[model samples]
Target: MVTDETPMPVLFKKSFKKLPMWDFEDVYNQDAPLRPTTCAESLRNSEDESFRKAFLPNIRLFLHKDNINLTEWNRLSHFNNPFGFMEYKYADVMASVKLIPKPKEPLLLPKPGGDGCVRCAVVGTAGILNGSRMGKEIDAHDYVFRMNGAVLKGHEEHVGNRTSVYVHTSFSITTSLYLFKKYGYTSVPNDEGIKYVMIPEAIRDFNWLEGLLKGEKGAGPYHNKWPRTYYAGQYNESRFYVLHQDFLRYVRNRFLKSAILNSTHWAIVRPTNGAFALFLALHTCDTVSAYGFMTEDYNKYYNYYFEKGVKTKVVFYINHDYMLEKNMWKKLHNSKIIRLYQRTDSGTGTEKPK
Candidate 1:
């Protein structure tokens, strides 16, 4: 069992020993065929050639310090259209606004590059993904990004075999490395193959990184041992825009006053760091597929699995609510805006999903 008293690495191993495997066959084989929502279909259908030239020119605009003027900010704010409006477009604006030493140029592509068409899989670690066998399918995408306490080091058969990106928060890194050391994932991968996406959840944490390069110490408990430079998505703001912002900027401005934000459920759920990373990836990549988010059978599995007897519930220290997460997954599943693998009961009577 994953006990607090267990030795470091052993603890992680024990905790992950219970990592669930997925059943891909059951997910895609349901009697009911998956259907995309009108809104989602609209986004995909519009991603063609003529549409890109006419509508999303600025999607690739690079706004670093030298040219990142208020005039530019204000000008870009007014650049909103019916499809993607101000506030929604403003997330990348606000996030890209503040930079320390300043960036050389923006990271937007001149023309969408990489594999004739770019497809990505943004995998989340909801308990529903426990036994999901979507690894091969998830890996099939051109780019695969996974986030937040993802325990895939030893469970490759379930989550997938490759990862191009791993988003991490300081707190999560410390916590996971400490708690699940037994799983053999003793440190966050900082190697070249996997890029680290940093979310500035705390201002001090952000400043601490800034201070390191400045030759200052005692920034905080954590120290930077890696080279300092523009880590692709570092910014003061969050990386996610709510549906209201998504619709207002990406759909139509009239939606600015829509009631979606007022949904009691929407109010209850706060955006997650992983959500921000996924959206950021979407803006950069032409196509995206979402995996491992909650499915209809969430409660069946605990919010997360620490160990058979260990009591570590996947927490909500941030604004995100599990109930809201519940609804978002359902909405995404129903809309088919993104594909969510489903859990299945196998012949061995073992729990399975993909």
Candidate 2:
């Protein structure tokens, strides 16, 4: 169970206790142009080849029946553990739901152009996007990934309108509907080619998948009122995907390895939904760029662009070590593995671009 009061381990206690300090000047700077910088040359010159090579495998991003031996379900059961540290019997769940088979080719394989690199943008909901005017830039990418309450109706100028993929958990989808009118989440992007990526964070997601596959909001958490229109009318099996458990575990262990995972508070130390989407792009795209994610001056922006009132500081949730994730993004940026959009005194600068 995720709780607001969960304690951080002693090793991370001090780091977690530092209150956010806002950079009001940077937040209000409207003339800043989004410039991208690359560290590829420097990273290549560094002696971290092995450190970088370990992350090059696409299999580290996800587990598919084609890539892993599903027959060894018993030995792999531990990977199916949910965010709350509760074990799930994926064997029975997998048998019940006829999952869409993994695509033979990577979804974001580069097409023949500009060095044949597949450029991707993982858009977050941070408040810094308010006047960033990054829409056209984001849409220019070969693929775009979004999640949660991605409000893009009126703010298309700040955040792009195209969505190649939308990632979410069952709870996120249901809650978006519950707060649709209030939060202005008018619709999930209805582009015909947009794929829905499911993060099976809990048992309810399994039930939700069954409902989605049947084309009826079957009996489950949504009480039969789950919107059928949210998904494609004629179900295309290829468009709906459930993230593999092993992939999620690999990410937690390698990239965002929070100290809390070793303590009794392990149940609360899962990655945020944003981290999952960002890393997913890393493996799928030739070049990945993250937008509206937390930065060193995170307190300068609102939690979300659509939020109204005095700028609210980003909250430190027990379920996510956001600081650690922020540092992870920085490290990857330094390694030229990802391009992270960050605020600079002069303007916005990104990790080394190709």
Candidate 3:
């Protein structure tokens, strides 16, 4: 029912206005079980070939401004403004940073092997992982990507311990530290050799990036001491990478393309941090399996697995079209683009199209 003609907020108003907010009691009720539609079934009935074709060509995974150069940057910047299209300002920020560290060697996106497929797992904070016991399965992949409040101490039995990549916005990194005890996120994933991918979701992120590279607090948010402990390990060039504004714009235009972009609320149409992480995996890895992302039965589970007894509903903030994201995930799964973790009566299974 979500079409380009219908605005994202209007769709939400029509479809989800009356849905009940989850209560604490819902967590104790064992009657509700996951009943996800099988990927095979969805693929068999899919009619959106045009959508698939649109995003298949250019999967701009990482932003090495050196490779993209200023010419391409200008072209893409004018094409569509991802984060409000302040190219001159963005360039200024980039130029101000003296040493922007890059990975010593490029990411092993195409692993040296027969098929050269890099298997990756993109983990979200959804509560469906509570008793899934998928920890071992998720960690078995070549790379594991986690974002936001990725609390792993007590829930390692379900969420795994290996974190190859930690994706975050400036807000998420600072907020995670701020709300450490409240959300039960004891620590951000600080394993040695782990890569940090920063999504430049706002101007604050650019400031934070400059501060991080300079090893000093900036005038922007997080003016307090930079939490260097979370980024443990020798200062290496390869440890940090920022998402390009052009790539983000491409994602919005090709995949999400929410009607909010054309309306007065252009800010709200931008993709969520989780969507950025998932798409990052899709482009970098040959095979991607998303766990804890919003499923069709998203309302049945809490917004986060770390919330013990409070069955909080996954809030669809004015900024994100969560329903549209859910549909995109489903479509990608059906098209064999990525594996979506789906819980059914039989147990948890990765949806791979035939």
RMSD of each: 16.0, 11.7, 12.6
Model 3 regions lying over 4 Å from their true place: 1-52, 56-59, 64-84, 87-92, 95-98, 102-105, 110-115, 227-229, 233-235, 346-354
lDDT of 2: 0.64
TM-score of each: 0.57, 0.77, 0.76
TM-score of 1: 0.57
- lDDT of each candidate versus the true structure: 0.44, 0.64, 0.64
**In model 1, which runs have C-alpha deviations exceeding 4 angstroms?**
1-115, 211-269, 305-314, 346-354
What is the Cα-based lDDT of residue 27 in candidate 1? 17
Better by TM-score, candidate 3 or 1: 3
What TM-score does candidate 2 get on C-alpha atoms? 0.77
Question: Which window of ten consecutive residues has the lowest lDDT sum in model 1?
Answer: 25-34
Model 2 ranges off by over 4 Å = 1-53, 60-71, 83-86, 89-92, 112-114, 232-235, 345-354
lDDT of 2 by residue, 42-121 (tens): 22234557446545344533333454343334334323244211254444355334544664335555555455556789
Displacement of residue 37 (Cα, Å) in model 3 is: 31
Clash number for candidate 2: 4
